[model samples]
Target: MDKKSPSDTAEFNISAYDQAEFNDLLFENMPDYAFVKNDSFKIVKANSAFLSMYPTNIRDKVIGYTTVEDYQPKEAELFLARDKEAFEQGYSETVETITFPDHRIRTLLTRKKRFEAIDGRTYILGIATDVTEREELIEKLRKSNDDLDQFAYMASHDLKAPLTAIAKLVSWIDEDHRSELPVGAIENFELIKSRINRMTQLLNDMLTYSRVNQTPHEKEEFSFKDLVLEQFDMICIDKEFNLSCCELIVSLQKDAIAIVLRNLLANAIKHHHLDHGNIDVTIEEKKGFYLIKVTDDGPGIDPQYSSKIFEMFQTLKPRDQQEGSGIGLAICKKIANHYAGDITLIDQPNGTSFLVTWPSVPTQQPPFKRIK
Candidate 1:
């Protein structure tokens, strides 16, 4: 029985790479375009994907040739400069567009690194990943976002003015012909006004949704109780919406947070069994976020409609029975998401509770989904 020593095993392992078949298998099976270039900037070795870039006639002759003639004169100069930089700096990465011999254009993210062989010959190893489709998809997504912003702006400025004018004209008619009108005409006018108000609210909320992440949230310090109280007052002017929360100073985006609180308070009041009810808000500092829980003494939502409640333009009740845009929760969800946060309904037996996670600062990492 023979057992190789540690030094002998290391030497054998290094020498085993001399097996040409193993090297050929690895080089041939690479999914990306890979090649090795000599000091002269001529490709000395290339994989199948690299060879596929050329015509059948030129495939065999591709080795020992530079890409100077393949690209435009200016592009060739820049490519040669980058090649030299990779040799000197040890690495270079770039996104390049290439028109193959078959006239198919492709965008690639290319990484080039310098290496030296055991025999002391210097070479540049390059690996290129095709990003043509990914780049196209990203561009389309950017265009789609821009179009939504434009539509929101149109809805706010252009569409809203005409809608307000129509509401005013209806009011003027009601005032001028109140005595001459029929019995149920007054109720019809009120219904018309309510529908108009709902549409206006929808437009405003849509604008808020589009602009939620449009600008960065600026951090500011304020009393949490004060902010919640202000929005509650705005939502429930004459009606009493009782709220109970411990006062604490908070540092976060004030305007966005106010919008979320307003929607939540309005939701509680609008869906409550009585005209006024108790609302409890608890705000505490977690590891990296401000945890906000808004609980109301109202009839809770069904577990089946939990996911559907956050959808845009979704309503649990008919429009005639309850006058609302139904975009409030969706907007609150959007604002929370924009800051690496989340808003979820805490399904309970008695009352409705909404748990909102808000990061103190702007972040890309999502907050933990731990909620009661």
Candidate 2:
């Protein structure tokens, strides 16, 4: 056979050379810290990103050594345990906060997996992505929301006491001067009382909205019919309204569900053109969600206003014409979205229909019995 020429040798090595060069450039230039450790847990290889993280004095000794001596005892133990888990289980992942040689702290999403090289030796490949800025942003946003909720709660509570006193004063004046005052004066006082009551209701709703998501919504077993009737009775004291609902037992967050039902029922009754109207509520389990349909024979919401109804303090009609804080549907939407569900308006020819999708979870307890 003829000896291979120099050109043939270069051509044979071209593909391998390109591949090796690409991998080397990627490992050295990548932003995330990357390292490889042997079964003995000694770091045998590390990228430029990893070496730059250590102090200048220790950088040269990092290879062929364990980092336990450079880290705290507890941190060393944790790192060793993670390495063992990766080797045994094939992979491991965790979020850890570490301080760099420059004294800068960083939160990292660390991933480690067992990788077997052509040398027939077992090794662990590790990668750590810095998430320090993301974590700080999340913490700041959480604190801001908590402060806003607290402010709303305190303001509403403080204002209610003075409002209550004003209402009482108006009541006393009417009782004491009704006989001596003109009919117009009596009407004026009545209007003042109504306004005071409206303000009080608005404040109460604001307080409820602020605390809507403060508590965890734990699932509970209860009669769906009973819950509807209970909330309806509270709102419809003297009003003539017919509520037809399905008789089903449901397992869900009881208080959160109550708020949804109460708001829907109140909207129907309050917006009805007549003294008596028909309201129907039915719920069915749909795969991963509970589909709740609340339909009422009242003036349906205009298509234009449908989108605005669920927003906080958004109402189609003026507050004077319709007495509401406009936070009812907002509360419902917030609670629904928290569970990865939604509330939507289904357009109908005459009546309004609210479709509330509540995410369903496996019942943790026995089924509740429906009351007759």
Name the candidate that leads on TM-score: 2
Best by lDDT: 2
Off by over 4 Å in 1: 1-15, 18-23, 37-42, 56-66, 73-94, 113-124, 152-158, 219-226, 242-252, 284-290, 359-372
For all predicted structures, in order, the TM-scores are: 0.77, 0.84
Give the Cα error of residue 74 in candidate 1, in Å: 4.8
Q: Which ten residues in a row have the lowest lDDT in candidate 1?
A: 363-372
Check candidate 2 and list the clashing pairs.
none
- In candidate 2, what are the lDDT values of residues 147-264, reduced to their tens digit? 9989999999999999999999988888887899999999999899889988898889989989988898789889988999899999887889999999788888889898989999
Quote the lDDT for 62 in model 2. Answer: 90
Runs of candidate 2 exceeding 4 Å displacement: 1-25, 72-74, 117-121, 177-182, 362-372
lDDT of 1: 0.85
lDDT score of model 2?
A: 0.87
